[model samples]
Target: MSSEVGTEALTRRGLMLVLSSPSGAGKTTISRALLKEEDNLVMSVSATTRPRRPGEEDGKDYFFVEPVDFNLMINRDELLEHAKVFNHYYGTPRAPVETALSEGRDILFDIDWQGTQQLAQKAGDDLVSIFILPPSTAALEKRLKTRAQDSAEVIAQRMSKASEEISHWREYDYVVVNEDVDHCLAEVKAILKAERLRTRRRAGLIDFVNRLREGY
Candidate 1:
């Protein structure tokens, strides 16, 4: 006889959404859009030994630290995943990510395949990995050139490395061919929505269902 509809209470465990692609691909653009639109998600800030560039703020862009400190963190097992890239060490701190997951706040990671592999190994169930690919090889080249930030030699280096990056496409949970930015964004968003709905991710669902059946 109750007119009101019953709503079950549930709490979802946060997921680590990883978006990786070759340099010229549109993962960065897609990541920016996702962060802007997704309210419950935050970018996973990484600590790096690389020098802070102009307009880069410590703890904002990256937690810039000395090489010695980075090594110390590695030795202490404080980093969830760490890698040496171009002679600079980059890593994600474990404490903050654990806190976020406990609070049910999703974290977005923009990292390479190696870092993704490390995270997958550490937190397989909590992670959703997506790999973005350009529409074509020529398109990838065009995008790198259009940026005009890197020199020709650098562009060539990136192009050469892209093949190896793309080869890891099979490793991801989802693959988006980034021919259209809007379409790709929508696809990734859809994947996130579906992943969030997974029964394993939503805690208290079983209890809520039992309460409903008992007329509570």
Candidate 2:
């Protein structure tokens, strides 16, 4: 045998599967489910200027960097995309993503609309963005409250920001209403299955088809 390879059985370029949603919209939940069930899919670890929380590793949770270092990365164009949020900076490094694509291993990005837009501009064809929307406004608020991870003030802030986030739904390649987690996850998986078949992503597809034609 040559070597142990990725779970993908085909010779194809990997894609960036970006799932964006407002707080408590089930995007994170669906992303976890997808990673658990799907083969050859890996999470995209981002670099941030924010301080790491308890139990979060340096490289695992995020590549924690100083603001100056993050600025250097931006200046060097080492980052595929960078954005400032809530007085902190976050960005995706370009090198690992390119390597993963060449190796035919898909990457899952749990990002926001800002990052998704930058990724689209940087690597349009490689990106498949999906925006998750809640069933209704009231339902979204209820979910936020049920999670109980934030204070009343923070929940209110998220709810307010959610309206803005939801407005960018039209920018995504696909949109899924996340009323039901299982059903929504199924739809997202279906989308991934179909996107994997895109002609451009199949690296040797043209030559393979030609070879088949010659044999016939």
Candidate 3:
């Protein structure tokens, strides 16, 4: 039993794990933590038409492109999911993602609910989406204020928009209230482990079972 236990890992197809949440709900914090701890899990860098900011790298931070090139990629079906935000287009390129999936390397998407929906339409079988929620509106507001990056007006605006974002919680496969960052991260990690073990994602599962049935 000791020798056979955890001897071999199964060959599995990868999944697209999406994390979405309202502002100040701790999704970004959770995402950073996951990337730090999870093996074979990497962030999905998006191609963007937005101008590169200072200290941002090309292809590393974002695949910065011109508006025309971005349109061309969309027309050519080179993007798995794409969306316009603040007059700029951002998209996940199809090629690298497909390659990663086939090689059983998971991709993490820190996208909004709308982008998650777009990914669902194109890759539902490979997608696992989670929505993070704050324990209460008051707590969420408190978090936004604590950040100190926003003025009173901006914080108020973010709170208003958070209401709309929170309404889409039902569309996610899993929802976790981020009252505590450590607890919330653990919940998400559990979800990931279960999803990775799913039969459909295990590429050689059928062969492995058949060998056992043959008494090998």
Candidate 4:
């Protein structure tokens, strides 16, 4: 088993990993940790019409564009998926994602359920979707307040929307309840590893098996 595993050439088509969660459920935290630890995995830089934040770099954190330009991209069918949130448009550009997949470099999308649905419609076989759930409603509310980044009114608004966000949980390929950050990260990592090893993803395996049967 060890020898066979070691000798097999690993050649796989990259996957689109979509992680969705309510506002405070730790999807961002898990995404950051995964990118840090996994060499071939990178975050999917989205294009948006929203103004860039103070520290965000163009084409890195996000591609900030005008609303008119965003509409043009949609018209051209250049985006894999797009949605409007808080009156701003955000989308995953198609070209970059296709290039990365051909090179076997996995892209992680930190998007909501609506975006995930669009991606599924466009790239069903290549996508692996996960929905993260909080351990409890009280815990979720506590997390939102603990962040201290939002005003009380905004936090209340998020709490109200969280249930609606979580209602799409049935659409995901996997679901993780984030009771502990480290544990949740580990579970997601495990899922990535297992998915990477799937027979269909590993394209080189067919040739390796053929060679073995021919006694070469």
Pairs of residues at least 3 apart in sequence or in different chains that clash in candidate 2: none
lDDT of 4 by residue, 1-216 (tens): 222634446777899999999998988889999999999999999999999989999999899999999999999999999988889999999999999988788999988888999999998788999899999998999889999888989998989888899999999999999999999999999999988888888886777776666764
Cα TM-score of candidate 3: 0.92
Model 3 agreement with the true structure over 1-216: per-residue lDDT tens digits? 122213234778999999999998988899999999999899998999999999999978999999999999999999988998899999999888999999898999998888988899988799999999999999999989998978889998999899988999999999999989999999999999999999899865666666566664
The parts of candidate 4 lying over 4 Å away from their true place are 1-8, 149-151
TM-score of each: 0.91, 0.90, 0.92, 0.91
lDDT of 1 by residue, 115-215 (tens): 99999998879999999989999999999999888898999898989988998999999999999999999999999999988888877477666665777
Local distance difference test scores for all models: 0.89, 0.90, 0.90, 0.90
Q: Report the alpha-carbon TM-score of model 1 versus the true structure.
A: 0.91
Error of 1 at 129 (Å): 0.3
Q: How much lDDT does candidate 4 score? A: 0.90
> What lDDT tens digits, residue by residue, belong to model 2 across residues 10-99?
689999999999998888889989999999899999999999999999878899999999999999999988888889999999998999
lDDT of 3 at 15: 93
2 or 4, which is superior by TM-score? 4
